[model samples]
Target: MAAVELTVFQVILLFWSLRTAVSQVEMRCPSSCGNICIPYPFGMEEGSYLDERFKILCNSSSGVPKLTVDGTKLEVRDISVRRSTIGVMFPVVSANCGGKDRNTVVDLEGSPFVFSSENYFIARGCGNLALMNQNQSTIGVCVSICDKNRDSMMASCSGTDCCQTTIPSFLKVFNVTMKGLDDGKGSSGEKQCRYAYLVAQSWINYGSYYSDVGGDSDPYDMRHRDSVPVVLDWGIDERVFESLVKNGSFHNSSYSSTCQFLNPSINSTNQSSTVQCSCRPGFEGNPYRYGICEAGRAYDNYRRKIKAKMAGIGVGVGFGALFLLIGLWWLYKVFKRKRSEKLKKKYFKRNGGLLLQEQLSSGEVSVEKIKMFPSKELDKATDHYNVNRTLGQGGQGTVYKGMLADGKIVAVKKSKVIDEGNLRQFINEVVLLSQINHRNVVKLLGCCLETELPLLVYEFIPNGTLYQFLHDPNEEFPLTWEMRLRIAAEVAGALFYLHSAASLPIFHRDIKSTNILLDEKYRAKVADFGTSRSVSIDQTHVTTQVQGTFGYLDPEYFQSSQFTDKSDVYSFGVVLVELLTGQKAISFKRSEEQGRSLATYFIMAMESNCLFDILDPQVVKQGEREDVLMVASLARSCLRLNGKERPTMKEVTMVLERIKKSENLTVQQESEYDRKEVMGAPWDVTSASTISSFDIGAPSSLDEKPLLHTY
Candidate 1:
């Protein structure tokens, strides 16, 4: 019957389609996985390609498939069958600069094996500041620093935890030098060591090359040193590449539909760079995966299942049949999602995120205490971190309060600037902060980096700043004497931990009253670590660009372009002066004698035995004259002219703790203290100029809304 003939015809069509799908020509991979095919010029070796230009090699030591450049095992995070070539992450380079005392050099040689011009180059860190020579020439370079550490934000690089800069386009290989500006974080080791290196942009996730590389990271067991991963781009000539992908390969059932090759030019040329390809609609696989069309996109267990369904439907419905159209649509979507996820995984690994996790655990850190949030989750939590939701802001970024899925409250600090240089520094801060578990320091709960600007999630502190109480008269308050002393003692203890107890040494270069945060219970929480510098005990401070808040910055360190633990001491001394007099650090007001320098003023007051004359009346009323005098003496000592003469944070902490204990005992004896009744004079804050004399332009106020959406 006619119906029987129709079924037979359908069978014939189905057979033809299957034949077309399987009859694909053998296309080589860029390289090989064992004996398996690695199509075209990207062969296992030179002979595998038309010329040596596209040569590739395998590394058996990888245990699984891996690609290498010249013999260096280039960690192939992924190979896109859709987009030819692969993503090979390189090790990151960190620079440690001594002050401008000498012209020391740290050579970076990625010589013969050139990075791809099509992709990007990234650099990161403070201390390791330099200008890079891309393609053997000065393309561009950046210098980053953080003035204060211990605040959740505020560092030399930005007001945030880290800073970043992007590499120039078309860079093949690069070099670094300390020519343009000098790094002074290496204040102590000014003679011998300084750091600099060229890194692939991919290696630095954010806040990458932190100075605290010694006992806090992967190379901790060894002597003090820090290394990070970097990424680079690669490509073959565009024309040949196009032919390889768009030749009589996939979808060209007939030779007529295949592309025609162009005649070679009448010149000596390998013609490798100018190649690309084409494909038909509803198709998304390499044109030369098998050197021709193949049955599936990327082959894996999951894809096999989808292919099986496709094949089964092909077997039953035949070609040109809409009978299984609905199933096809859904399958396509699933396939696309899987492909995207695979790419993300590839980027994640290439970014060394996986390695970081491994290292954190090996270092005996409780990795579970830290969480990695998906980019989208954070976007929603803060209204995509809307400007309206931002409660405060600073140099590197902005802060918005967010609620996580676990019902945890957090303050999300988001950066406005994102580039290659600070990318790694950002990642480094995240890793370092995640490992630290301090009660007095604001906790770094988690982070999200997939977004353009980085976002750090911290336990939110609702009480605002110790500055607000000392200065702002919002009727919301003036801190009580007990509250002030407790805050000072707690902050001192935290600083002590940063100096000696923590695994690595952290220097808070820009310490000030505003940077000190208070919790709802009035407990002190030392916030911001952006301008902080970490140094190994063996190494001196790294030379860095002059960076820090104007009034709170160390005068000796700034002039000398050097940094030290004592640098933090000098800055903290300025903070003490604020507490004693309720005065700003660098006010343009008051008599010259009172305003010459807070340090000078305090010293003069102490030497003249006029300490009581300058003490905040509220402070004097709240404590006995002897107790007030005792605290004032300590403050004066903290403001010593010589950094070496200033007390160590540990010693400072002991002194303050003794004072706190004595004050608390007195409160207990009196048993009639009322926190709500008495208060100090309204704080005479010497509001710092928003623009430091060194900065290019005025940065946005930390309290105003951001120019862009917080999201």
Candidate 2:
């Protein structure tokens, strides 16, 4: 029995299928362009079509008849009906010859026309192997032997720089991959690069088989020389050209253009058994005749003269209409601009810009140190805040790059969606950020309120967020041991400043690496205070609704609504694990044993004494495995589910500083002593003697692993 399907979903799908079918409809061709009479079975678009199968695209981007088929352009010079071929200029390969230093690349991401079984492949090179495939299925492989360009090269396909092989007939979708073969051993010289192309029949001279040059090489040089073009046999419904000599007619409008079947003589190999009907030359409306080919002036110019004159009068009226349209368009643009200005003014007032200005005048909202950028200024800086400017994206909003009037660069954050609920919070964040002055925090420069949504401006940090630098593949910056320690220290200090040094004790509820911005020199700056709360000086903890990034959220706070300074420490601990392992805090790629969060993995690794295994090789290269281990251990201590078990941000900062100083002292002592002297030169994971061991089987020093606990 079958499952019952939803009626509404089926109806929607049926409607969509019908729409797609109607859009793909085509007609036969008298597709005319530049005195070239195009025949039936060729199409341009919906209105002017020959047939779907033979569609020709006239790209007018450069104001010339540059042609394309399916989106890939082929320098199509001519198409001969009798010859059944398209003359195209396939690009030639150029070799860069440099001794011992070489790089060869071939990109065929987009192209049309498949390698047929009738097509042949020839190669010339030593230490080279050629491979060709289609749709992940291998067709053939060829290996060549020859190192340097010899003075007298052989003209035979005899295991040397030359070899030839043919492909299966009428095959579509081809991909070529090549490598160098060094004797049977592997690669050497300029011959290491293998070059191949489908050669045009004209380029293949009688005596030019596998030789680098032609016999009668004149001043014209005989050919361009690099890529030798091969001819591909093309047909509608046949592999062999002779098979197209059909017995009957085909109604091509029903499917993707029909012709004779895959045969030498027409006895249709097609599903319906071959019947072909091609439109006659010079007279093409449609094979279906029902297929629409809108009337063009050149077809019946004698009768069209009067219609053409009236068309010219209509064209003049059209120009007047176009002129009226242009005038209306200009007027519409002016109206749009006025409407936008009014909206901006409305938003400016609504966003408390007037109140901000009043505060600025009264010395409440300081404008001297902060900025008030015009919306236009930011739009030009970020190319209207294009998708490319996006630094990171999430459920909240997107951050962009912007430049201020004073020549300072800033990060402009635009909300994903704006409404009344958070509008006051947005303004408050900016106002609070503007008042803050701290070296360890990402500084708020200014903001733009006269836009659809509020735009937050902050000091630009070029090194990106610590999260991306630690884990994103696209980001090449791997967190080195020293850099990691320094970043951790800086982040701790920043949090300490936010918690105490600020006018109010601010809880940066989200303190993950993703929220920590880095400057050019890897200077850490704490950011993303969207979930932060301001509490009184005497308060040790604040009661609030739980909210933060998953993987780094304080477990205690998540379970209970109470958040504290230790909550920030726990979140920062997740950042520390990221720095050590060079993996995402919440990575999907992990063994089932190692939980999703980096903190969980780090704790597991620390417990198992396999923390070194999870660390980045770049950090391992830093020769401070002991110091790295200590930091990982500290990070482990911070991630303890119980808030009481986690270190204070102040202690975290102090311990990190002590670790750096101790490493420096150890290095100095090793330099002062002989090879055999001193406790150890530096920590090295590879040098087993210097590696530190952590106990895995023992119970955690913390009381217990609580199911959930906040600060």
Candidate 3:
């Protein structure tokens, strides 16, 4: 009776699986156009269609299948099920070569498809201008110019013989037209055809489809004749998924399928919400079919065979052997646990955990101040160091967001290098940060040493870095002039404390806008002390390898390999310039004459009496002219080529503080006061006769010797 029941159950299971597979096949569209498979949701036959937009018409009158979208007769080259895009060929218009001027217009209005952002409007020909218009409004124009006598060299659409520009995203329709220059004249008296169309970046960049020249050798000639692949993004309303789920539809029927919401355009509405579906992670099959999320067939069959053998063994005197094997496994686990613990202790010692304990015990360092967390605790907190928990990355190492057992959020810094030198620095950071107490500095909570690389835990900063606030377009709130001034003052104060008021004189070698973080209140928090050096009271400066960001590095220290308090001041001066201009430390978009550093451009502007030209408009409007000039002048003195001419961090902090307080002071009075107090002050760098008061201008001093820029 038992054997009969088991057989009956097995038969039922087999029947159910077979029934599900057959139903899935029937629901899915198995039709094809030549070699291209028309999957479900996209159908070539009326019975296989799920909607009118998905209907693909196939013409086979010529004995070759050609697919058209929605009976529009536009040939479909290929379809992408994963990316939710289709490649179609569009007509291209040309001039000068006398090709028929068929101005191509791709009209996709009221359709589920839009022009993908991955395509570019490109025009290939000299002495021609390509104009792209949308909704009868001119959107962009690209002109290519070439000398008649010069040899033509094809470039990658960089405004040379071929000119290209990016099209707007979410564009539903566009018209491409070309105009010939100088009465339809061609380059070098040879008729050149101008081709303009929207083409996929991948296809154009591949460069494998160019036509054979046959000694004619026009680079713009296309091998595929009048057709080029154009990519279109397709999406449908999210309600489709809900309907499928509620009605038990086969479309996206797999259990391991997920839906993604598309980025809606400004004109998107509830009736036209866009969504897409794809197979979930670790599953690869047709998402529109039942049982689509199953693992590979080979693995499933192997597992079944192994299970059958195990069942037979269990029914025939294998219980005793199984019990013995379980006992051995338990012993092996215990041995492995002990070995792991031993290795953890070894790593702890190697990472200076023992030395830290010794220092605490001897009263050389405070006791029970910095916690030493176990490796397992940190690993669990960070979910085995998942990439999703990553807060940010830098040249030093990666930082991950972690939650402690006590429900406290923290930042876990994982250093990349484990060299002897870096190990010492890591230990030093622990020691210094444990004793250091400052509200504007990031707090060191604890550390974990069991891992190959040491991990440092710091108090989590809620807001992003100042760089994001200054440059990121998506930042909800703009950095106002008042806020920038306050932030500048706060960072200057922090640096002042580090340079003069800390337990030891610490020099922050790297000080830029990026290194400065903002907290919940938008207050500045100076961070990243990996390259900081501590100096003794008797020592004037430290001579070591120069290390800092390219645009912010102090030119004097960069050329001398000698770092001092003034070096940090120079970097901070660059930060001051950043705050003033709202520009990056190194900007590639600026004109070639400006050089890479904003400091150089700012200095030029100040020298040329065009300070307002480069000042942030916000700063100009909110700040008084005299105040803006004062701050600009202060930044200029800080950025002086001579280290001695730069004001100290203390002076910078005082000036920013005074500027913030003197907002109500009249311009006349302010100018008079500046002339009286700051006339002979070291901050004055306008005239060449200003003398250095800090003895930094002498060549014999290491503080004045310029360093080489090379590492």
Best by lDDT: 3
lDDT of 3 at 228: 68
TM-score per model over all chains? 0.45, 0.51, 0.57
lDDT over C-alpha atoms for residue 150 of model 1: 32
Query: Candidate 2, residues 1-711: lDDT per residue as tens digits?
Result: 011125334544655554444344323325554434455444456645333445666654542233454454554455544344555444433233223222222222222233334345554455556666655667667666774554333334545665556655544434565666656444353454455544453445354443544553321122335433434334443322222223213333423222444332212122222223333432323332332222222234333454466467556765447667557767887999999999999988777677666655785444455577889999987878965577766555889876656777778888655566765556657666776688878888778888877787878999887777765644454566777788888888888777768777778888887788889888998887766776778877878767888998988888887888878888888888788778888877887677877777776666565767878887778847557656765676677676766656666776677677777565434222122211223222222111012222223323334334433
lDDT of 1 at 123: 29
lDDT of 1 by residue, 213-304 (tens): 43343211111323333444333344544554585323334221223332322122232223333334324335543334334332333444
- What C-alpha lDDT values do all the predictions have? 0.56, 0.59, 0.71
RMSD of each: 31.2, 21.1, 19.0
TM-score, candidate 1, is 0.45
| TM-score winner | 3
By lDDT, the candidates rank as 3, 2, 1
lDDT of 3: 0.71
If candidate 1 were superposed on the true structure by all CA atoms, what would the RMSD be?
Answer: 31.2
- Residues 336-448 of candidate 3 have per-residue lDDT tens digits of 99999998888887777776676667875543578888888889889889766988999889999999999999899998856766666667678767766788888889998
Q: Which ten residues in a row have the lowest lDDT in candidate 3?
A: 689-698
